[model samples]
Target: MPVTDVTTDPENLTMTIVADFAAPVERVWSAYSDPRQLERFWGPPGWPATFTAWDHTVGGRAYYSLTGPRGERSSGSWEFLSIDAPHSFEVLDSFVDDEGKPLEGFAPMRMKLSFTPTAEGTRMIGESHFDSVEALNQVVAMGVIEGTKMAMAQLDAVLQDLREFAQGKGTQVELLDDTHVRITRLVEGPRELVWRAYNEEELMRQWMLGPEGWEMTECVIATEPGQQHRTSWAPVGDTPGEPFGFEGEVLLVDAPRRAVTTERMQGTDGPETLNDLNLYEEDGATLITVLIEYPDKETRDMILATGMAEGMEASYTRLEHEVLAPAERS
Candidate 1:
């Protein structure tokens, strides 16, 4: 697995993967075209299915879940484009974020998955286009490509091992996956005000934690890709207590507009974990997207299971009631 090319700009990121398989084009087609079959072989092995619904027609949707080895699970939907039987197909894919909202920035992938019959078997080629090169890059930076490929490799293995049920040898898929708590809420506020809530320490502290008992003790900010911005919280009972902290570099920042990139260093064992936050204004309101990309399945599931949505909702709720409220008055 040579590292896929990683290129970035202020607006987008792109990733490409080329691989071949020994299965016939038809078999390969089934693995990608049919939602039922597609779900079986997708994602890292040991990933279980929670629910999968497929409508294999253009304008139809395919929804499925894949639980990773460490119980980390993800669910996403696909909108079919042209379903060329046994040869090619196109679909859109996106997951329900921690907020349980389909962040437009992260969904609707236009993928051209084609299979060419070869003397040995089939040469599979897939190309997914974004609304623009920037979107492609944004997702690539979000770590979707690596995750998608990991899941696809598992799919490849599953298809190869498929046996004839008539021969008493059939591949059985075990659907056991982890689940996450996702919460969604819409905020109506100016982009600048909302940006202040995130970039300004005074405002960030207001909504970043509970009452003073759990106030943010440490706040640091640096405006660069490798910079760090963090805040800490301490419980009520501890005396001279150290606050729980979050440490992450400033991957990319377009202050007053959006900040996209990674986080996680305080409690992790390796490099910083991944996170991104975006801000877009529409019709006098600012729409923001915040993403937390875990380094591995273990962390992914743990972070999800830790009530990320609830925690975030609490903060956003505060932002609305505290910060945005004041902005509205003025």
Candidate 2:
């Protein structure tokens, strides 16, 4: 319903769609920047999308699968070519296989999306450039225009759901699937500061401790892929609790934005989990999202039963009051 116009230029091998929304540019932009919000409306009505991987920085790639009502799936990948926050981003979009390899004989398209302020709200322009007329005609024949219109129509509900996506909601958890759990917290700080608080030993020692009466004893931060990072915590003074620690190998790092790591108990051979941390800033507050993939449903249930969400909330509170507050003051 937000779509105002849709056009296809066969001579130029391009298709453009224009939509207007009654939401601020930032609000509209966040819906696309965050994978959680994106998946809610990325696919058409009957085809819900699941983003298996999302790396939003330039040169990064995102892989997603759209599952049809009949259990069929269509996979796709986007290679980010350019990104200018709250303004524009370009990506090489492709039809991909399950493993994210582009399908043979299907040429990829270059799509650029832009967001701009309007008197009423925000206007979004999405333009796709195909390699040849055949390619452009091919996609149009496959219901691309109608599918896109249906997908964008769903964005209206997401933008209006301020309570669910707004800041200061504390740490919240969502069970994405049998093995994937997503935890999100909106912190009162900039993205850079939050990213630093997670990577710097001094800053982490100040707030990474969960609950009161505990102190961090060991902190080894990882700065690059494949590096090992470890942290340990012990109860201080008369506080009653045994010492514990976590160790992880960083699988990917895009500073100030995203990091992916493998985490497990320090000395235990227990199953490990994949943690994908993403940070996005809007209106001076940063949204911290961590998507955790457990080895199985049993492991997921066991971990959540350990008061992990409550503990994370405590840590995030400390992070704001102790780490970011001081940094902001300075």
lDDT of 2 by residue, 204-260 (tens): 888888888998999999989879999999999999889999998888776787777
List per-prediction Cα lDDT, in the order shown. Answer: 0.59, 0.87
Report residue 59 deviation for candidate 1 (angstroms).
Answer: 29
List clash counts for every candidate, in order.
16, 0
> Relative to the unseen true structure, what is the Cα RMSD of model 2?
10.0
User: TM-score of predicted model 2?
Assistant: 0.60
lDDT of 1 at 83: 80
Instruction: Provide C-alpha RMSD values for all models, in order.
Output: 16.9, 10.0
Error of 1 at 81 (Å): 20
Candidate with maximal TM-score: 2
